[model samples]
Target: GPYVIPSETPRGEKYLSRIKLSWSTMATTASCPPPSVLLPIRTTTAGARLTSSHGSRAGHAVTTTGGAAHARPPLPMGMARALLPQRAPLLRRLLMAGALAASCTCFLLVLQAQASVPPRYDGFAYGVGAAAWKDAVLVEAFLDPLCPDSRDAWHPLRLAVERYSPMVSLIVHPFPLPYHTYSYHACRALHIANKLNSSSTYPLLELFFKNQGKFSNRATSSISSTAVTGEISKMAAQAVGNSVSEFQSGFSDMRSDMAARVSFKYGCTRGVAGAPFFFVNGFLQPGGGSPIDFSTWTSILEPLVAHHGQTIEMLTSV
Candidate 1:
């Protein structure tokens, strides 16, 4: 059977999206040049100039009439993603667009064949590693802290995790939704609270959900100012015992961003058509519930969990 990519994903739009989206699925990192690099990086240069390779290898030269850039601007945080080898060229191209300068030269990135996609497990991967699962199969929820459905469902998830802490790892990944200005902040707040190692992810999740109603109904809305969103995220995270600055830093951590992006990417690859998505092992369960209640999770999840480890291993190879 041909593989399926979810519709909400940018990857489904074209070959590049499809390829980058499949990097983790294929257990490979796409081959491409690093983003922040000098075009013709030369070691021996007196002034603003160009050097193609090391050892001052003979290459073209361009003299700068004015002052040179003190430093290269940082690459966009999410650009250095680990994707599958065959699919990475597209993302590399996307990042290259950001590097346009007045200097005129044909930039060619020599991609090396190194296939290593970070073992990026998603779902509430923030501040610190998530609480370990017990015996029951874990339902690691990669939530959008500002999402109302996530707020409602988190209660039940908290209960399940606590009751079956011995059986399952209820990992809370409050990932930022691209559209919601507060979503990322909310998630980061929870991550900040986690710095203490025993904060209640449940309360943190709930507070954000309750206030989320005031944010906006539209998908692509911003939370007005960084100050307001930061305050709300800080308060929500504090409910679970996280300090403000700690919460703030974790909320903005680049690694946190990368982890969330990885989660979102996996959601696309795993057929996660919408939020409140559930990835139980490799199979996807409906958000919050299926057509029914707890039985829905049970009926569909039990058998799959029973044979999951082996099946997961098999799926990875595909």
Candidate 2:
């Protein structure tokens, strides 16, 4: 049988979407009752009674009385009036129960969508490390070039890298914090420098961290973004041993901003809210958001190295 739409009757209305009904041959027998033709209905806002005008087939219009609009469409009500009286009562109960279950399911789906975390980082670049090493674990570090805590973490991290080369690698993500006005410029500088010389990116970061005081003061001294960019461009040229003009072209390219933005977005998905955030093996390190002591980092790395069949002394000697 064809799907039934809502029909405005004295009792109420019933609406169904894409429904298929199985009609028995007995339905046409004299003992059976007539099939109710469910037609689409529209209600009025004036609290007027439902007034329907249409046949059982499609292409028919059902209008409300008094020409008023529907405030809310109600759920499908009791079974069609033409059904056997005994069957109508049980069928209506089942329809109401199903509607309630569907409502609950929809609510759960919405909550699940809201609670989901955003996508995380999966690509390479913006770090000083081999893209992949079977023996090595990948660490992502989020840093704001002008933050003091970031500087504090840099030393231990670099020493760790030297000691754990093929066994551990760090991917630096420049997440210039909002409060550090000049930090974003510094991050952009690192991005530009990386393009000029991949090896020079970390060195450039080191330079910025060492002289954060100067950068912070300059940032607060009412200098324009262009002026700061020019200053950074010159520094980048010196760091990468490239001609100033050559460095300027790469620094000014739109890709510099693109690189910074990609890194920032990746960090956000991983829950990086501030500078000096660290993730080892894609898991956030305990107390990684704060300035961790050198010994603490060594404690964290020693077991990882040992687990990978490499001792600290062996890697340090290498």
**35-132, model 1: which lDDT tens digit per residue?**
11324322222322222454321122333335453444443334434222345577787667755631222333212322225574545431222443
Candidate 1 segments whose C-alpha is farther than 4 A from its true place:
1-116, 124-136, 161-165, 196-198, 217-223, 240-243, 249-253, 286-292, 298-318
Cα deviation in Å at residue 268, candidate 2? Answer: 0.2
Clashes of 2: 0
Model 1 scores a TM of 0.47
Q: How does model 1 fare in lDDT? A: 0.51
Question: How does candidate 2 score on lDDT?
Answer: 0.67
Candidate 2 residue-wise lDDT at 201: 82
- The number of the candidate with the highest TM-score is 2
Q: How does residue 10 of candidate 2 score in lDDT?
A: 34
